[model samples]
Target: MNRQPEPRQAIALKYDGKQAPTLTAKGDDELAEAILKLAREYEVPIYENAELVKVLARMELGDSIPQELYRTLAQIIAFAWQLKGKFPEGFDPDAGPVERDITPPK
Candidate 1:
């Protein structure tokens, strides 16, 4: 049987050291293309997880991601930070706080 792939879906998230990652943008098809283009132009790190994207695409812009996604998203965020040689302040591998602890905005 022949099968067709799903249309592209993309989401942009912003994470602050103090707060949960927020949904900055989301799109499908052309919009998804545009979002990816901008990310490329800005040299932003892109981490693709089809399953995560599906869940995130459901969120509205400015919404903090749900709690359950923390661990997986944290790993992705850590990867981005590593790529940039950036890390949270006061973080010590031996004694620092856990890397991620963003509560959804009230």
Candidate 2:
């Protein structure tokens, strides 16, 4: 039997240089489309990770991400920084962003 795909989901996070990332917005379906449209309009970088979105979408608006997600979220931010060619001094360009681990080892 065929199964329908899950509705699209989007989560937006903002991180200032000194603070942890905070969830700015999130939604599924039509709202997801609107979030993406606004991001596009503002030239925000988009990264696709359904599993990450699933977890992030659970957070309340304006909540900072928990410590456990720091490494993964850092990778995402590093990717955006790379795209803009604005890495901090001594940052290694040859070492690409960390791989996202959907499941952590026990």
Candidate 3:
């Protein structure tokens, strides 16, 4: 029987107003490179500022895409599609649960 490939989710890499637009990549460096290559092929300006890029590059799957960056990218992509944006649906970047200590009080 033939099976359908799992849907790949896109992570938006938002930035501050002073920075450029970007997209988040999986942890694998090569995978990230490939994603960046595609973005470049489309003539999209991928921001490469040191300080900002450094922080974004380190974002892991479990971490919530920071609010500032989230808003920035959301707006850009929203506009890029002329407000008929196609954000990765059902991809809740902040859906993870919070952790807490359960040690007994002294």
Candidate 4:
């Protein structure tokens, strides 16, 4: 019997209010390409943080994304969506229920 090797999963780049991260091209080929492409498509400005990209390259699929990392990615997605990018269309910034007075305005 022959054993198949595990497939490499693409890393999901995250961003923060301090910096925007993205790839150059599409697909899961290379980390840089994917980030640049997504940035361009979404009109999000990428930051000059090489270390971030390096960390992303080291991330493996099925791994739990770090809390800070997740927060950063969420910020980027929100920015893109707000800018009317095709990446996150129709995504509400506040998709959860909000506590507010439902009384009619008098």
Candidate 5:
């Protein structure tokens, strides 16, 4: 018999000026839809990466990301900040452009 694929998964993380990004929400199927809906309602930017979501889904809510994922997550966060046209705290506009070439985990 053919089985349906697993429902879509989503993970949300929040990074304030000080602390590392923490997993705030995670869900599958309808709960995933609700998470996306709330994010849209609040005008939150959504980044889609199924592999990244799969890795992050292993963590319990409120857990800071592992150091191994720091660089990858930083790139994602930086991209989000750029989309919002805002820099992270202590970012120096006068410091000239920063170059980054990030490869997502396999």
Candidate 6:
């Protein structure tokens, strides 16, 4: 007996420092490949976390991620920003939490 491999999943997020991280794009299989390819072509850093992807994929396009996912997604965005040498003001990699609270007021 043979088991088929799981299809690859890809998700894209957008954060403008003024809003919650939003689900920009998500797909499986071939579409995932296309999204990943574009990321490579543009030198975008790719973060792979199957659990995170599974959670984020549940959100609709253009929807900001839920509050529960803020801390997890913050790490991803922080790393991406660090890679581009644009660390947020007062951010301390050694700190337990992000120095700045980017979450919008309720």
Q: Give the TM-score of candidate 4.
A: 0.36
Task: Tell me the spans in candidate 1 whose CA falls farther than 4 Å from its real position.
Answer: 1-4, 92-106
RMSD in Å for all candidates: 3.5, 4.8, 16.6, 13.3, 4.2, 3.2
At residue 47, candidate 3 shows an lDDT of 42
- 18-85 in candidate 6: lDDT tens per residue? 78888899999999999999999998899999888988888899999999888778778878987988
**What does the lDDT come to for candidate 5?**
0.88
In candidate 5, clashing pairs total 0
Per model, how many backbone clashes are there?
0, 0, 0, 11, 0, 0
Highest-scoring model, TM-score: 5
lDDT of 3 at 77: 55
Candidate-wise lDDT, in order: 0.86, 0.87, 0.50, 0.49, 0.88, 0.86
Structural RMSD, model 5: 4.2
TM-score of each: 0.81, 0.80, 0.35, 0.36, 0.83, 0.81
63-85 per-residue lDDT for model 3 (tens digits): 54555665445544545543333
For model 5, the stretches where C-alpha displacement exceeds 4 angstroms are 89-96, 99-106
| Cα lDDT tens digits for candidate 4, 1-106 | 8887433323344433344344322223365466566667876565444455455656554344444565555555555555664343444546764354423234
Q: What tens digits encode model 5's per-residue C-alpha lDDT throughout 1-106? A: 9999977999999998566789999999999999999999998999999999999999999999987888888888888888888996788868988786544355
TM-score of 1: 0.81
Those runs of model 4 whose alpha carbons end farther than 4 Å from true positions after fitting are 1-48, 62-64, 85-106
TM-score, prediction 2: 0.80
